[model samples]
Target: MSMNDSWYRASVGDVTQRDALQGDITTDVCIVGAGFTGLSAALELAEAGVRVTVLEAEQVGWGCSGRNGGQINPGLGCDHGRVVAELGADDARKVWQLTLDGVELLRSRVKRHNIDCDLKAGILLVANKARHVPELQSWQHELEALGYDQLAFYDRDALQSLLKADYQAGVMDWGGGDLHPLKYALGLASAAEAAGAQILERSAVLGYEEDGRTVTIRTAAGQVHAQHLLLAGNAYLGKLLPWYRKGFMPIGSYVGATRPLGELATQLIPSRAAVCDMNTLIDYYRLSADNRLLFGGRASARDAQPNALRATMRERMALVFPALAEEDFEYLWGGQVAMTMSKAPVFGRLGRRTLFAQGYSGQGVALAGMAGKLMAQTVQGDAAGFDLMARAKHWPVPPGAPLQTAIRALALLWYRLQDSR
Candidate 1:
């Protein structure tokens, strides 16, 4: 299937297209990118009666926000234990609460806006190997100590009732779930507009110049002068700001959707919970509301989509459920996601008036929106939440593109070796 043939795009109905930037515009806060982060921030700031303008290179939800696995996994990108070790008990508890709040915020927005995205409950983190079972147990204990009580452990036999895979064990998180990502993103944009935010599509930001008082953002056809700016471009930020590029590596991940499986879908996953294995290169899959299996994983450092993506996805799916070997895939797509070395999001400031958030690793579905909300709070004179998130350390990737690519390749190779054992 072509890149444009993603199941999300095929199913997204009646999206309102906004005009591109023309002439100059001014707002209290200017945002770059209209994905989850930008739209979420726009919604928050506009509801607060702040003037906000969002600029997007393409349509809203055109990036990873629309194309991701759609699994709303809880917590930060890394385990909670790592968070506690790095940020102390008190701050870690705050961070943990914020992550849960992110999930709740998503739920509330979907309900408040009457978004038709098929929101569902339950997510299972499964152990791909026997060694991973103990690690999952430790993870569960760590979260329970942090006051999260929504988790339940399942051994191999117990897992068979929900999933017909070879996973050694699993941890079911009742708090996390899945949704129609493109529809969710579009709903955020609509809500932001209703709250008085202006969103301009097809307006790629060329660059920006920041004076001590105001920041001027320039696109091909227009410029936006604002008191503050929020960079929400994530992996798609490209070379717009070379300095930020070093803090995270953009990796391409692929996903495929089979033709509606009808009754077999429920048999594959009886509980309908999204499942992700404990491998470094994880396989995440869940059933679509219409019954198709949306399977994703297989990370690549290359800029282009991997060759024979459908065959590769089918092979991976068959490994977990042999019955799917003959299934016909109707859609295939891939997109880049920013990943930090520490697996925690990278959030910080560019100046007194400029703030940026990105590198959610594999957990951008919910955390990116929360990052935007916190940035909006910071813009409105409440910086405590943003400051706490900025405390998480993000190690820079090697400076040059070639060096970073080499490092990513070596890392993927190491992960493959580890997963094999």
Candidate 2:
């Protein structure tokens, strides 16, 4: 489907367009990609009285930030137990707390800026299979032990009362919820601009060169010389920084929005909480402000044809709610999700002046904004939070595209097998 057909684009009303980079400029920090990460940093830095310039390849929030599932899920992309095992209890607790803080940060931003993004509360992580039930229960206990108390376990009957799905069990996270992703992103951009940052759209960065003291970023029409550079492009970073590409694989995830389901929507999800199964390759969905069932799943390492994407999404959605098999999808679109080998976010510094954070996997809605804030803190001489995230190890994929593709295919195949079991 044409990206222009995105329901987010249609629902966001009109946004003020900014001019592209037109002439050489200098700033304290030059950020590339005006998505959540960059825009969040811009808002923080600008408010701190720092000269920040954000250059976007397209309009602000044009990437996954604007097109994500909008589920404000708390915690890391990977399992919390694995994180505790890898980083140990103390650091892992800190990391877990940061994720929770991320959710709150998003809420505070919406309230502080009066962002009309339809923010809501509650999320259900349902068990797709009987085997997954024990795992979800254990996870909930683990979080409770770590001082998080806003979770509740639900049996199949209890889950059925809330969500009309044949799931075995579920864990309700009262802290997490959903929102209009594009509107949240646009609000951030506007807040950042109002805070004294300059945002340039349609100014794709061609390349950049640094000479010890300063980094010069080039665009088609202009260049930016700044003391520091932040790369926040995520999957869309492309070949700008090839080394970072090896650390994450860009996976295409598609979402389909059914025509407003009205009362059917409330019947399917009475709690109005965003829901997702616990499969290795899970199906996530939530109700839009207008009551449309916005379902998402069917991810692939490589891009698929739009028709095929829509068909697969339809099939997936039908699997959850068979009554909607014949429902018409009013909108369908795909966005790139950067998945690291470990599924943890990748944050680190390059040399002394360049920094980057990406590979949020499918958990960028809240975390990405927090990451940007932490990164800005690092730039302003406080690296505690950013340092903790940077400490997590992220292995790089094989060097070649062909090898990487093969690895991703094998991984997906393995996940499929696990899901089937």
> What does each candidate score in C-alpha RMSD?
1.3, 1.3
Looking at candidate 1, what is the lDDT of residue 80? 78
lDDT of 1 by residue, 1-421 (tens): 2336688998975678799999998899999999999999999999999999999998899998989999997798887778889999899889889888899999999999999999999999999998999999999998888778899999999999989888999999999999999999999999999999999999999999888989999999989999999999998987665553347898889988989999999998999999999999999999999999999999987765544576778899999989989986788888988988889998888878889989999898899999999999999999998999999886766667798788889989998999999
Candidate 1 similarity to native, TM-score: 0.98
Candidate 2's TM-score: 0.98
Candidate 2's C-alpha runs over 4 A off are 244-246
- Candidate 2 residues 1-421, lDDT tens each? 3456678888988889899999899999999999989999999999999999999999988899888889988899888877888889899999999999899999999999999999999999999888988899988998898889989998999888789988999999999999989999999999999999999999999999889999999999999999999999998987777663447888888888889998999999999999988988889999999999999888886777555777778888888999899996888888889998788998888778988999999999999999999989989999999999988887865666777678888889999998988
lDDT (C-alpha, whole model) for all candidates: 0.90, 0.89
Misplaced by over 4 Å in model 1 are 1-3, 244-246
**Candidate 2, backbone clash total:** 0
Q: What C-alpha lDDT does candidate 2 achieve relative to the native structure?
A: 0.89
Model 1 poorest ten-residue lDDT run: 238-247
